[model samples]
Target: MTGARPRNRKELLAAAAAGLFARDGFHNVGVGDVAAAGGVTASALYRHFQNKQDVLGHVLLTGVDELADRLRAAVSGLADDPGRRLDPLLLAAAEVSVERRELTALWRWQGRHMREADQKDLRTRVGSLLTDWLAGLRALRPGLDPGQTQLLCFATLSVFGSVGDHRATPGAGFAELLARLARAVVGVDLPTARPSSDQWRTRVAPPPSRREELLTAATRLFREHGFHAVSVDDIGAATGIAGPSVYRHFAGKSELLLAASRRMADRLTLGLEDALATATDPADALGRLARSYVDTVLRSDDLIAVYTTELANLPERDGRELRAMQRGYVAEWVRLLRSVSPGLDEAEARVVVHAALTIVNDIPRTARFADRPGLAAELTALTGAVLDAGATQP
Candidate 1:
C-alpha cells in the first residue's frame, strides 16, 4: 500500500513550535518537545532551525510580517489618502488576529525571548507599519501628536492581542467590536483635570497585614521591572523587610507571583459572580460586570498587569490553577453574552469578552488617556461598545 505523503518538515516545525510556545510559553517549552510535536527527531529539527530561539524568532517575526502585509493591502486602494486608511488598517489587523491565534499570542508574549538583533529587526518592521498608520492618523487628527498617535496605535493593537490570551473564535461581529474600540481609543479626547484637595490631604489608614504588604510590594515591583528581573531582595526592600523574611509569609519569589496572579483572578471571578447575581437581565448583568471589571482593574492595575504579563514565572502547578480561575471567570462572561444574544455560541462570546477585557487593560496604559476626567466612564463605555457590538448585526 502507498504511504501518506510526508509533511514539509520546516513548515511543520514552525507550526508545532508556535502552538507549544503559545501554550507553555517560550521559556517553558524545550527543543525536544517542539521536535516531538512536529513528529521529527531533534536532529531533524536542528537541520531546519539553528536553535529554539531561531524557531521563536520565526514565529514572532512571521506574525509581524503578516500584519505589515495586511496593512499594506488595507491601504492599497485609498488613492494616496493615508488619513482615510486608518479604519481599514485596523479592520485588517482584527482580521489577521482572528486568522492567526497562536502566532498572535507569540507576537504578544514571546518577543522578549528573542535575541537583541532579532528584536531590533522585528521592531524596525513593526515601527515601519506604525509609521504608515501614524501618517494616516496624523492627517486625520492633526491635533494629536506623534507620541499620542503611537500610544493610540498600541491601545488599538492590544484589543487584537487579546485573542492570543484565550481560545476565542472571533466572527464578523467580534471584528466589528474590535474596530469600534480601536477607533474610540485613537479618537476619544481626554478632558483636562487636576487632583482634588481631598487627594492632597494625607489620611493614614491602619497598616496592612504583612502578607498584604508583601503582596502589594511584589505586585508593584513585578509590574514595573517584570518577574525574572525583580528578586526576592527587591520585593523585601520595597516592603521594608529582610529578603529572607519574605519566606515567612511566602515560599519564594514564584509564590509571590502566584499570589499576585491568584489575587486578580479570584477578584474578577468573585466580582463577576456577584454582579451576575444582582442583575435583572442579560444586558444589566453585562453592564454591571463591565463596571465591576473597571473597578477591579483601576484598583488593582499593578496586580492585573503582573498576572497577565508575568505569570510565565510561576511554577507549573500554580500556573495551571491561576489559569483555571481565569478561564472560569471568562466562562461567566461567555454565558452572559450567550444569554443576551442567543445567536452567539460560546466561542464567539469568548472573543467578544476577551476583546472587551483587552480594551480595559490597555486604555489605562495609554499615557495620553492618563489623569483624564471620567476615566472609569470612558473605559466602561468602550467596553460596553464591544459587548453591544457583538449583540448587534455585523
Candidate 2:
C-alpha cells in the first residue's frame, strides 16, 4: 500500500511555531512544543529555525511582509491618481484586519518583543511601505503636507489596526471609520486659544498625592473628558490646584493617561489574582476574571476610552512597560480561559481573549452611539456572559 504523502515539514513547523508564539508568547513557547505540534522532531524544527527567537524573527518578518504586500496591492492599481484609489485601499486594509486578525496579533506581539535593531529594520521596511502608501494617498488627496499626511497615516493605522474588520455595519469597519478618522485628522478644529507651556505649567500645581486624592481627582477628570482634551490645566482645575504646579507631582498628560488606564486594569488584575489565589474552586477563576475585566472597564467609560485611544501614544519606557503590563493584564484572563475550557486550545483561547479585550476597550465608541450608562452595563454583562459561555464550552 502506498503511504500517505508526508506533510511539508518546513511549512508545518513554521505554522505551528507561529500559532504557539501567538498563544503562549515569546518567552513561554518552546521549540519542542512547536515541533510536536507539527508532528515533527525537535531536530527537524531546529533544521528550519535555530531556536524560538528565530521562530519569532520568522513570524515577525512574515507578518510584516504580508502587510507590505497588501498595502502594495492596495495602491498598485492606483498607479497615478491616489484620491480615487484611496477608498479601496482603506477598505481593503480593513478587510485584511478582519480576516487576518491572528497574523495581526502576531505582528503586534512581535513589535512589542522587538529589540532596537529589529525595530530599526522593521521601521525601515514600514517606512518604505509608507512612502509608497503616501504616494498612493497623495494621488488620491492632493495638497497635504508631510506633517499632515504623516499624522493621518499614523492615526489611521493605529485605529484601523485595532478596529479593522470590527464594527457591526458597513460604516463600522476600517475604511469607513478610517474616513472619519482621516477627516478628523484633516478637518477637526484645533482650539484657536492654545495655552503656552508656561501658562499651562503655571496653571498646574503639585499634588500632595496620596492614593485617594490622586486617583479620585485624576479619574474624575480623565474619565469625564479625555486624555488630550483634559490637559494639565484640566487636571489642576479638577483638583482645585493651579495648573502648572501640577507638573511637580506628575510628569505630564501621557503619564496621567497610563496611570488612569493602569488603575482600572490593576483593580481587575488584583481582583482576578486574589480570586484565583483565594477561591477553593478551580472552575470559577475564568468567570471571576471575566467579571473583573468587565466591571473595571465599564466602571469608567473614560478609562476604557483612553486605554483604547490615547495610551498607544504615551512617552517611551513608560509606554513600552505599560504595554507589557497590558499584555499581562489580558494574559491572566487567557490563563483562566484555558483552565475553564478544555475544548479550546491555549492558542485559540488567546484569540478569544484578545477579541474580548478589544470589545472592552472599544466600549467608549459604543457608548457614543448608544446610551453610555445602559450600554456600558449591558456590554459588561454581555461580555461576562460570552466569556463565561466560552469558558464553559470550548
Top candidate (TM-score): 1
- Estimate candidate 2's RMSD in Å: 15.1
Q: Write the per-residue lDDT of candidate 1 for residues 91-149, one digit (tens) a residue.
A: 77777777786787787777777877999999898886666666666666778755555
lDDT of 1: 0.76
lDDT of each: 0.76, 0.58
Q: Model 1 off-target regions past 4 Å?
A: 1-14, 35-51, 76-87, 138-152, 170-210, 221-234, 237-242, 277-280, 309-321, 366-374
Q: What is the lDDT of residue 87 in candidate 2?
A: 67
In angstroms, the error of model 2 at 110 is 2.9
Instruction: Return the lDDT, model 2, position 176.
Output: 44
In candidate 1, which residue pairs clash? none
Which portions of model 2 miss their true places by more than 4 Å?
Answer: 1-7, 77-79, 139-144, 163-394
User: Residues 73-119, candidate 2, lDDT per residue (tens digit)?
Assistant: 77575648665676677677667775676676667544445555666
